[model samples]
Target: MCVWILIGLCIITKVHGYSDGDFPQSCDSLLPEHRRSGVNILPQNTKPPYKVTYKPGNNGEPITVSLESNPGHKFSGFMLEARETQRVDEGPPVGRFISLQPDTRLLTCSLSADSAVSNRYSAGKTLIRVNWTAEGAELDITFRATFVESYAKFWERVDRKVTIQTTTPPPTTQPSTAEPSTAKPSTANPSTVKPSTAKPSTAELSTTNSSPVTTSISSSTTQNTQRPDALGLKREGTVQMSLDILFVGVKMELPNIITITITNSLFSRGLIKVSNILCSLLSMAVEISAPILFCANDSCTVTLIALMCVVIVINFMDLVIVSLPIGPSHELKDICDLAAKVCSVIHMVFTIAALFVAVLEIDDCRNNRKDFWLLKVMTAFTVWICLFLIWTFVVSIHRNEILGRNKTGSSKWREQGKKNKLSAAEVIVTAVSVILIMGTLSFTVTVIAGIFLAKQTCA
Candidate 1:
């Protein structure tokens, strides 16, 4: 009895002792039978960044993975790493990884059996963390090997996945007339389609134009890609005339019209100035790349990467300055910082555009297969821009709230409470900035990989 009890205790301890290292670390380490799988990790708190659904190979069916944002938090996007498990004695390693941000919550990925993804190793234990700076809230979900497989199957049965389908109505057929036609229709095919005689939708005819616009929206859609021209340029004169009439009528409201015109002029001028600054900065990046432009193909590639790093540094500085806590009475400093933040955002946008151009201008890239490194950088930048937009909103909201509350002349304790909340908001901003910097650094590494590849070719 004593021996049996000791053995039972040993078994229990072994079962509970499984650690992160025990899990498959790469796609290659995953069981051959379990290829194309997902492991769901439930969030520790509410508002998880994303919910994952892994559908392991279903009888001979392709493996599938689905992701959705949890309630109270929207899914922004994700970066996935798929590494090939290295043998203990292997000389070197190679693998594939990709980042994607599908807008929909019900994003699905189908992994084919023949795809190389099956050969890549799993990312070992994974974590999904979501931070909502506005609400000063965060949630973390960790996936462990011991529970992933079981949880995935469990969620499959509990969560029903639904797909939406849209159907277009069938075209109406004209009824055959009993009376004989006076003249038979031409046998030759018409070069152009006859315009529909039906009146346009009220929405389509309601477009306005007198506001310094380039074109009038005279159709239901702004543009129809399915059409031959793809611009929806075949608008009827009647529709155009209706829009003109409405726009002219608006202009007749003299005071409102004058105010709108002034606003438009100011906005347009501000946009022009911003654009000019961005263009100049981009030109400077190109000039920096010029010294090594012709030394070697590899040198040119390096130059492009260096330019990207410079922009990243500039943006990082801007982020740091913007993140500095504003004193309670520092309104001027706050306004200036806000303006600087806007300019920094525009600078980053132009910088990203410049990097794209630099990549495209690469001689090797033109002929060689597209590099995943560049794609990763692009994805990172796209995600950063989205986050920046949200961060701006959060900052604006917190600033307004704090200022509004301070105006109320609250008690000392209440003021302190507001200050605490403001501090939390600042912490969130700093955290987001750090995240952006980390992402940018990762992207830089990816760019370096391409540069190294170019160097290899030159060798």
Candidate 2:
């Protein structure tokens, strides 16, 4: 902290105010040429509190320009000048201020003397009145100013566009459609300048113009990858997907819940130690991989959120293993198992559908191919899910065949005709069937919804 204070003080010592109307460096941007870090151009706030009050002047007539701020707002310094309306963004202000207040003086720009008018002292003042004489050559002209509330704060490009009528008026062939003589930069944006101070939302206290966070509204959107102009853009949907990883814990797999209940329920389960562990590991790895996109940036929140989600899923899986009953007499468990499996089907169907929509939404751009590896990942996961359905069915059939052939060695309860529990094959079949049906429905709903949203957005 002490070191930082010293650094700030050292920089401050060299940062003298541009008091003597010596800010020709700000000719283009209209911002004070401090060029130090931590200052920036913010977006418009509310309506501008300053206004321009003027009357149309004919050729050779000296025009009065009044610059006033709203009550309670005083600017310590300002630079005011007029430019041709056609070159508003680029033209230079030249010798327009013929008479100026003693507190304000004329600025000799790079090419022209008395090219602009500015406050001569760094004292807070509310109003500046000056006389501008048109040098016989006349067209439309506008008055713009950069007002400094203080050395450290100011608003640039506060302008009011008005038509200064030339002395020898041309034939008024058509009715003047020009707006009222009064002009404010833009009614839509106050000051028509970056304002609201927004000192708080400072592009991470931006020494530059960009202030968007990792998952900001701008970064989360997926843009057209096919545009050659987007070659340098971040991978498509990467930011949005990273944000989605935080929900993995809440989206715990349904099959894992059933697997935990099988050995302790009416379902006579087979060994699932291998496949069960592999499935959970695979899914968790996929969720974890999502954070790799964030590695390029310094946003630790993405990594932390992803890890937190992973922890939640692991805890839920553990809870399922620890809580279920150890016998086949869980009548409630039977009903719950069936219902949960049905819900699982519905969930997977939606999952599959969502994955498909994700694939469809991928930006088809050659340059973004490497960044868009997420699409390939979605396809691989889909294939694996389909394989899980087929593998479970095939294993269950094989298990049933083996069990039927060994009927002679069946449990005493089965031998005595008291068998009522569901077999491994039955359990597996129910789980697989529920998944297939629900997954299909999920896909259909996703595609239809995507289509509807696309139409709405395009329209």
Candidate 3:
């Protein structure tokens, strides 16, 4: 039973960690059949079984060729050559002779210049040759090739294909024209045509007299002037559509919005959503951490709750500030922005402290199952809160430039500001932003370390 259990465990480990379930068994799968058929050469096995791996490289990277031999058999040394199959350009043969280390089971080498391979990856193939001495026999492998394509080249091809696909309109069928009417004209029309000598009806006379006035009015139609914001609306629509397409993948959970009304709505709802999530995490953390932390020092729990309340208030303030309209002067906007920046700093400080405290509490949590799980939950919440905080900080930094500023206007004030060294306030804001980012990072690291330490202690 123990033997079978050990065997099962080995099988599970191999399947989960080491086995390549669906990967190609050989280098033959690297290129299309036509490309592989003519170039692939089966290496001679004069001594024992071995495997060869071919890896095509990308820009600024080298092509890797490796050989692995069975135990008690290995290649002593090898010569390799690689050249582009289609010789539109002439260059030095990309080949080298590599000596294997003594008793080494595996030997690998890079062929061709990394720069050259990068430059000629698209529609390029490197014909390779290998010759080696093993088991007192010299064996050679010739003409094996791998297709090469840099990631940049691959994306370029994709873009070209996408452009072509988008631009090519679907096949359209012309509406068939009806055959020309062939019925002859009425027989009596030409000879029996009569000219009426009657006086015109009153309505017809009135319409004729009124027709000139109507015609004059119609001919003198005024063109409606475009609204001042019409062009702005068109540009906004275009930009919004572009963003919607770009973020369609991730928009389900975290949506991107650009329009004024929609952006305001998103922020209002997002603030609530973020606050609820944070509150849930805080409650979980408090519950899990109470035994380890609150029991020893109840002040820490009160401090955490109080910090959470302050954070909630700050978030509420942010939502309010964001919801506010831009007043006649930019002063109100700047003030709101400044408030948000300050709030971010305060939030960062508390968040970092909370994470640190939670992690510290986990030192006592190793023996208690409840304590262990709760600490983990708290750590997770702290990480999430830190992530949201960082995002808020970044958004605050770029909010004015992206969403509030006039794109086309020239600002002498900004030019002068740039000419002058940054003001004390600007310097302070910059310093705080940097500090906030660093604190968030440190807090995240603390949470991760706390989790690691707890796991190690449990183990």
Candidate 4:
């Protein structure tokens, strides 16, 4: 029994070894067939096998050739040559040839192999040669083949159909003409016609008389007209009156009036729209960044709210300014007047609101350093924007004044003032006002630039 048990254990071990065996017999047993064929079953450190595959006879179309390397060897590149001979111009003799060099891992060449084969060789035979080289291989591989028909002949039939269609012309029809009438007209004597001249037709008489009467009326009217033939006026006085009215209308709507109105309207609206959008986005961004810059405290939120209030005022002012119309003549003047009034009201309101917000922010920022810096910047920006608004209003008012004075008397204020001004108080007031306006514009521009830079840096 012990011997039987030991033998059984040994049998189990043998079965396990066979199940997990490394040397697979199925492949190893094919060595004899490989030897009989004289082909290497496994070649080590040998040149990779290069084979060229081509479809011939145009295959009813173009012929494409590709090169494939043996497994475990990468396809580096290939050179393709179409020649009459197979051995590099040594055998048979080459006719027309084309060579291709593809510096790629897999190379392919498609030849329009529709040309007739030379009679010296087969009717539809062409020799394709491919030389391939792979990385880490010493010997280059060469592939050769003679292509023949191996695909459906569709292109030939298509070509024949195209040729027939191109050669054919459309059929045309000949036009038919009407035949002459065969019936003859009846002939009667003058006696049979009897005195059959119908009663005198009023229509014919009226037609005959119409032309002379119309001509007489036209001549009389032409003589009575007093204007030149070119202007078609009844009298010279009427022509002068028409010219006066035309000139007056043109003067009322002068070119400069229309141009300046359009330019100012577009400029103001464009600036307002752009500034509003930017300011709104900036306000939202500041709100979002409040927590990051300052701790989530009461004072920080107050400061942010104060800053946002100032932005709201500025945005409101921009909207009001943009809504004003600057257009043709009277309409533009009316709009300008309305805008000036609305602007003055809004400016006063914004100024008061901004001052209140600035005071609140200053109080809030006393407890937070970050909030203090932010509020300080906000205060400066608000003051700058207010000053700019005021300066713009002053410029608009001044322009209106200049236009009004010019219209009243065709004299400019600058020239007239230079000639007549003599008061020191007036000169001092003018100098101070100009300086203030210029200073305001410069300060506003500088603040705007600084704010833009700060935002960019923070971003």
Candidate 5:
């Protein structure tokens, strides 16, 4: 037991010694030489002339200066001196350095601990130079002096008031004069004048001459006074007339004339005559077809009766041209030629139908409830048919790849067989085509509905 107890004590002592050795004590300290080394330390609280105070002056104000240190540092003793160099010595003199011995027990120093030393520096006109040595450090440091303008001078200039005087000219004075004497009549004039001629009296002659002169002067003055105002009125009238013409033209072009008129009145400021003429032509076109063509009870009836008879005749002529045979070819080439003919016919039919509808809609028949619904449906069908035609075009261009053929068909019978086999790949193609068609159809229908709703609301 004595041996075990002795071994345990020895182990405990060794552990404690190791722990104590690992623990930290004092921080790293700088030597006196290191502290005394000169460094370019920037002043914390000293923005040079170190301090500033302003008092009134004849032109402006004078600024005063004080020198001080940053907080947490002692003032120690300081030298006030200008910077000296080999070429120039233009700074203040060196003075006895004052010591700032801070007493920890003093309340003033304690309160001032948080305040900057510059706050205690007196404000005066003298330029301040500062050199400070820290309490324990032997090296000397210096800062150049400067002066800052006061806020009062800045504000005074910014808010300065000015006065101006204007003199009025004195009223003019009119001269008073006596009336002129009347002239004596010439004695020989009445007798010497021809006996057959009648002699006019002086009063009559004077009145006749004066009347024309007075009238001419009055007319000239009136024209001069009214010319500017008359010109202004004429300009205004011309502008208004132009605006009226523009409005008329727009009404002619658009189907919804009333809505257009209201919109123009609300948004447009002036008239444009060219716009009016164009709109009028468009309106006439729309009005002509509305009742007879677009709103007709039967498509065949409108097709026969409408002015687009010329277009119909041309399309018929094209059909005839396509049907006529030009040359013989292989089976695949024959099928391609046949497809081209069918595509051309389809395109012609679609174009004729579109033109017919457009002409009828322009005439104003689009406003009819039945006609409008028919048109909407026709438009939707047309869009779908266009998509189908595009797909057909793509399939035609890549017929071999789509039909899983290694090369083009050599004969008409082989071409027919390949086209027939297309039905076999329908499941995949149809699914993708349907998805694309449905997405496009939904988007188109939504847009058309929105347009219709906006038109209705605007109307």
Candidate 6:
């Protein structure tokens, strides 16, 4: 136990500690001083996986600068700096960080103290905000950051421009100078106030009831001047949303995609729904449909049997048709191999147990015993557990397939996953998956609803 504790401590320290002490050593170039072996990595040429946003700030006041990464995209280290927009390329870091978030620290990238900000440790981060004080005439500046996902993956020069909102002293609320009520009669004759030389415009010249035309024209002008062209705004919003989705897909780290996909597919939805359905759906029968047997319902036994049967068939087909030769246990030769072995054995046990329960369930429903409730509960949980393992098994196979590629870069995977057309097998499997999920969900809901209505009474 002591040894294990020590090892755990070591891992935490290694992962969270900042070995390269905070300094402006590489502030000029913003390149991480990493090992020469270098993993052949380069700055991402694609849409950045990060976003930099800031509310407008008055000069001399601290602006809350926020750096946020998209869902599932996290970084381990980062350096943030601001530069005068006009001299962005040549200028030193401009703003001073007055305050900072935890896990971040100020750096003297320029001669000034706290001229830049950076991560204090190497731990993963999804979002960070810092209070940077904008000073001087260079209120219009650009923010740039270098995000390090890992030693091998980082993007430098992620940039955003902001013009600090400054208060112009409210335009010096001027005193209104009242004009004389009567203009001293101009020192000229009354005849001198002749008709103006300027000719009337075409509409003004038409004195014969032109008010309607003037009103219509003025209304149209007003409509055009007002904000929010509905169609234009909608179109812009839709395009931005589309691009955001596309960029999100393209920016995913390839190394994490398999694990993230498997986890989300299995637990995020499947596990939650499966457990909830099984635990609650059976109660309907107990409350109403059971006629006394929420525990006695035959659906649990039947569903369990069907699920186990499907799993068994899937295992057999995978071995014979999909994996072939030595089966998936040897074919994939990764975590999938272990999953193949474990899932098959667990499902086999479940099938036998389910069949055994089904017999007792039928007999009990006929004779009406308290043990019937126990049997129903057992069946529900068993089926749920089996589904969990089944999803794991499914995900492992898919994960192995995705990770088995001989590729090196994330870009290649993004291009392939995005631009590639679906194959016939892929299309078919996708359709089957959709159908299966819908059918099972519907089945769960129906079982729950069944409890609401008592068994049909004989007329």
Model 1, 375-456: lDDT tens digits are: 4555565576566556554655574453233443233434556433334433444455555545555555555555445434
**How displaced is residue 434 in candidate 4, in Å?**
5.7
**What TM-scores do the predictions have?**
0.28, 0.32, 0.24, 0.23, 0.22, 0.34
Query: In model 4, which regions exceed 4 Å deviation?
Result: 1-325, 328-332, 344-352, 359-404, 407-434, 441-459
Off by over 4 Å in 6: 1-20, 36-40, 165-169, 172-459
Best by lDDT: 2
2 versus 3: better TM-score goes to = 2
The Cα RMSD of model 4 versus the native structure comes to 37.1
Q: What C-alpha lDDT does candidate 2 achieve relative to the native structure?
A: 0.49
- Per-model lDDT: 0.33, 0.49, 0.35, 0.32, 0.31, 0.48
Candidate 4 local distance difference test against the native? 0.32
Q: Tens digits of per-residue lDDT for model 6 on 1-459?
A: 999999999988866444434566767767676654645457667777888887544334466688899998988888888888888787888867753333566676768877878875566788776767766454788998888888877888888998875454332221111112112232334453322221222224344234534554564344334312212222222222222212111111111323233434334334433332342223222212212121232123234335445544534432432132332235464544454345444434443354333333232212233433434543563474355346545644574354343323133344567435443433444454444445344433433232211111000
In model 5, the runs with Cα more than 4 Å from the true position are 1-318, 325-372, 406-423, 426-459
Error of 6 at 20 (Å): 7.5
Candidate 2 lowest-lDDT run of ten: 225-234
How far residue 425's Cα lies from its native spot in candidate 1, in Å, is: 4.1
lDDT of 1: 0.33
Against the true structure, candidate 6 reaches a TM-score of 0.34
Off by over 4 Å in 3: 1-300, 327-331, 366-446
Instruction: Please name the candidate that would achieve the greatest TM-score relative to the true structure.
Output: 6
For every model shown, the clashing-pair count is 9, 14, 0, 0, 19, 4
- Model 5 C-alpha lDDT per residue in residues 1-459, reported as the tens digit of each score: 999999999998876332111111100100011111454222224332222221111111111112433343223211222112221123222212221211000011112221111111212222222112122322222322222223111000011111111222122111111112112123435544432122334434546545645654564455345433323322222222222222222222222222222334323312322333344343234333433333332212233234334433433443344344443334454564444335333533443354334323222211233444434544564565466556645755675565454443233434566433324443344454555445444543443453344234222
* Cα lDDT, model 2, residue 275: 35
Q: lDDT rank, highest first?
A: 2, 6, 3, 1, 4, 5
Is candidate 1 or 6 superior in lDDT? Answer: 6
